[model samples]
Target: MELKGFSTKCIHGGEEGKYEFDVIPPIHLSSTYQLKYEDQDFVYSRVDNPTRRVLEDKMSVLEKGVASLAFSSGIAAISTVVLSFVKPGEEVILSEDIYGGTKTLFMEILSKRGIKYKYVDTRYADRLEDEISDDTRLVMIESPSNPMMRITDIEKVSKIAHEHGLKVAVDNTFASPYLQNPIELGADITIHSATKYLGGHSDIIAGTATFKTMEDYELVKLHRTRLGGVLSPFDSYLLLRSIKTLEVRMERHCKNAMEIAEYLSNHPKVEDVLYPFLKSFPQYDLARSQMRLGGGMISFKLYTDDQDKVDVFLNSLSIMKKAVSLGGVETLIEQPATMTHRALPDEEKKRLGITPGLIRLSVGIENVEDLISDLENALRNI
Candidate 1:
């Protein structure tokens, strides 16, 4: 029997009942599996592990990709995926509003290898064609883009890129597999910062890459293996356990976020609110067409421009933690100007709409009324 439902896949997607007959897969902690013959199933932990295999299989189903690879972190997955195709002198098009770590990878790492990239406004799919070059190998984007909540038309962008012989890879960290499956929308590869919603907790740090074809899968896997960026057996188990509750957790996350966005939109202290589900958002229709849910991320600017006011608001938030990464069960609030995107220059940050007054919130599964009160108290104090 096979599971077709999303929630069913969450519980039984991988090699669950096939091995050990345990209700949940056990941790395969052995670094070396017994291999009498050359035809043995598992040999070394780096090459593969029983626990990690289950995660890869499960991730494949969730992302609607032909195969999946688990990496040490989100950056490892992105680096391996990009390096798999992009060579010296070649270029790739990336989302202008992508997370800061990604921008660093392009400038600090890829540039040293002679691989180049251009940052573009991917929300407008039509603008993508104007940026592609003969040397371009990949079209990478982050829909509901990092902290900005920008939406990209996956089908439109993928179609245009395919015509130009470019592969499309979407960083689906913000939306998670519950809200969106990029592979289903024609993306060649879908990447995830599994440390976020996939883990559903702040305990694990991991990444995943799901490929549309076996060839792409094998290529990236080869890069991952050679680069030695595989996920550990223990962390793999944690990720698998987290996936089982992905559907239910996402339900609460989406619910809490919509209410929070609505609350902020009307607040006197909030100058602007950015949420895909909000009708006031420019890309609401595009987001609805590609994503099943609006996701838990929200970015808004406060009415005041004073940097000191940010500290007051952040310090007043008793329930929300001030942190960098997002999508955990506990709500996280951060000021990108001083935290995640601090590496970015002031002009560039301003151009990307990461304003001095902007606040990025990763809404969690806490009681909606409680969250509202928390935000209200903070806003009033600020």
Candidate 2:
């Protein structure tokens, strides 16, 4: 059957059983599949599992890529893709504002191995070209960047990288395939922490990497196997089930986020709101041009620089839970400096606009008025 819709693809694409059997995809618990003479399909669970393959196939179709690989966690997926291209003494150009774990992987691990990285402000597309050099093999960026909500020009950056013979890797966790498809805009690889939006309920921890061509696919697949970062069959089943409702979940997430952002912008204790959909955002135009939706994440600053005020604001919230990760059915709020980006130097964090007063909000599929009231009450206490 020719699948024509996203939801349809999610529900039917990876499944093999018919109505006589269970409607849901059966979990292939067996670690090894029996093989005929000289033929092997699923020899072992670690190398290949039938259940995991379904999730990979679903992700490949969603991202419009040639192939997809599942990993134990988002960091594992990122490390696999980065290591596939990066070598000792080589360099990578990355955005100043990125996931804390990714930044740590580059600074703490890769740097120890003599692989260097330069953090650039990709908000200015012109600066990207100036930073590229013969040693720069990859350009990594996270659009609607973490904590800051700043967006990079994917098309511009991809074109510049190609001109310099550099490969482009985009972290599409914030703006999932529902909001943006990086490969369609010339990105060589699209990565996601499927633990967040793709898994929707915050029940599973998994990551995915989708490659644009067979060559790139083989490179990442080899790294995944050698590094032993494959996802479990059970986690794959959870992810597959969660992806079926991604479109609907994301729609509500975007709508609720926009409302919450507006409410925060008007609050007395709020200094600034950093949602791309809002007109007050610096990169509003770019966000509109590149993303299909504004997404559920919002980052805002408090008027007070005092740490006491920040504490009061966080403690006053009744509905929005204080949490580390995001993209769940319930709203989540976190302080990046202490939680996500705690490992980075103070100077580097400040350079990337991560401050003590900055708060990252992941608006959930709750009533808009209730979410706004929760924020307003928290601001009142502040």
Provide the lDDT at 121 for model 1.
93
| Candidate 1 displacement at residue 180 in angstroms | 0.6
User: How well does candidate 1 match the true structure, expressed as C-alpha RMSD?
Assistant: 1.0
Worst 10 residues of 1 by lDDT: 14-23
- Candidate 2 deviant stretches above 4 angstroms: 16-20
lDDT of 1 at 158: 96
Whose lDDT is greatest here? 1
The alpha-carbon RMSD values of the candidates against the true structure, listed in the order shown, are 1.0, 1.5
Q: lDDT value for candidate 2? A: 0.90
Candidate 2 weakest ten by summed lDDT: 13-22
TM-score of 2: 0.97
TM-score of each: 0.98, 0.97
The sequence of per-residue lDDT tens digits that candidate 2 reaches over residues 1-382 is 6877877877777564432467776688887778775767678788888888888888888898988999999999999998999999899999888888999998889999989999999989899878997899999999989989889999999999999999999999999999999999999999999999998898888999998998999888888989999998889989988999999999999999998888889887788999999999988999999999899999999987688989899999999999999988889999998898899999988888788999999999999899888888888887
